[model samples]
Target: MSLFSAAVAGFGTGLSLIAAIGAQNAFVLRQGIQRRHVGAVVAVCVLSDAALILAGTAGMGALVETAPWALTAARIGGAVFLAAYAALALRRSLRPAALTVDASAAGPGGRSAGRGPLAAAVLTCLALTWLNPHVYLDTVVLLGSVAATHGDGGRWRFAAGAVAASVVWFVAIGYGARVLRGLFARPVAWRVLDAVVAAVMLALAASLVAGIPG
Candidate 1:
């Protein structure tokens, strides 16, 4: 196939995998709506995915196969991280003042926090990306294996396309969420959203624990 075709294939495949409503997307959506360090959050997510896609394209998938323990470690760490985060989200819902702050917070370009808040946001984003085993499965393994079908030159192009998709999708989710500003202007809405985030995070942790089963 031509480079263009390979790229299109990669874009579509990546979209299909990431478009699903998972922990990463949920966190992105929440950050987007909260308008707290959105640029940083989006950049972290996009860059992380790009790195993973490139690693997969570069044949890191084989290394992953030889190091199955890596994923197991990620799974355990991710679950703990996600569960703790879920509890935080749930706790936030109980604090009316927290949602009030979210409702009147800055725009997509606003600072969600400073010093401590920034550090927490960045740390959470990193944990959400690196701790998640599914990310390794889908990007490093599945996407990498799929890229091989396009041959050498085409595979790189495919990886590029996938990376592009990550950039586009994250930008859209992070910035596009601003359109719902009116809806999220209410503190109740923020609370509801937090509850949903908690549920999603817990669900993701549960799925990780279940895995493929014996």
Candidate 2:
């Protein structure tokens, strides 16, 4: 296949894998709506995806496949982290009035009074990306296998396309979420969003647990 075709295929596959409302996307959306450290959040996501894709292209997928224990460890860790995040979201949902007041007091970027510190947010982003076993399955195994089918030269093109898709998707969702700022201006909206986030996090946690071997 031609390099362009390989790239397009990779881009499409990458977008399809990540376009879902997973933990990472939910966190990005929340940060975006809060008008918080969106750049940092998006940067972490994009760079992480790029690194994973490159690793996959370099055939790290085989190593991951051989290590069943690694995935199990990641599954448990991811589930715990996600469950804790869900509890936090649920707690925040219970206090929409406080969120509203704090959000109103929030200053632009850097360190907003209402938003978590940049370091904390970045840490959470890293956890959501790295700890999830599914990330390994999807980016490393699946994408890598597909890229390999395109032959050595085309595989690099495919990987590049996948990385491009990550960049585009994160940037769009991270910034585009601000369009909902007007709606989230209401306390009820904040409550609803937190509630939804909690649900997504919990569901993802459950799914990860279910994937573990008996």
Q: Using Cα atoms with residue i matched to residue i, what is each candidate's TM-score against the true structure?
A: 0.91, 0.94
Give the deviation of candidate 1 from the true structure as CA RMSD. Answer: 3.5
Candidate 1 lDDT trough over 10 residues, lowest sum? 107-116
Kindly list the per-residue Cα lDDT of model 1 for residues 17-105, writing each as its tens digit: 87888778887887787677889999999999999999999999878988877878788888899999999999977775656435344
**Which candidate leads in lDDT?**
2
In terms of lDDT, model 2 sits at: 0.90
Residues 83-131 of candidate 2: C-alpha lDDT, one tens digit per residue: 9999999998897544552444743343344566789989999999999
lDDT of each: 0.85, 0.90
What is the lDDT, from 0 to 100, of the residue 160 in candidate 1? 89
For model 1, the superposed segments whose C-alpha errors exceed 4 Å read 101-116, 212-214
Cα deviation of 29, candidate 2, in Å: 0.4
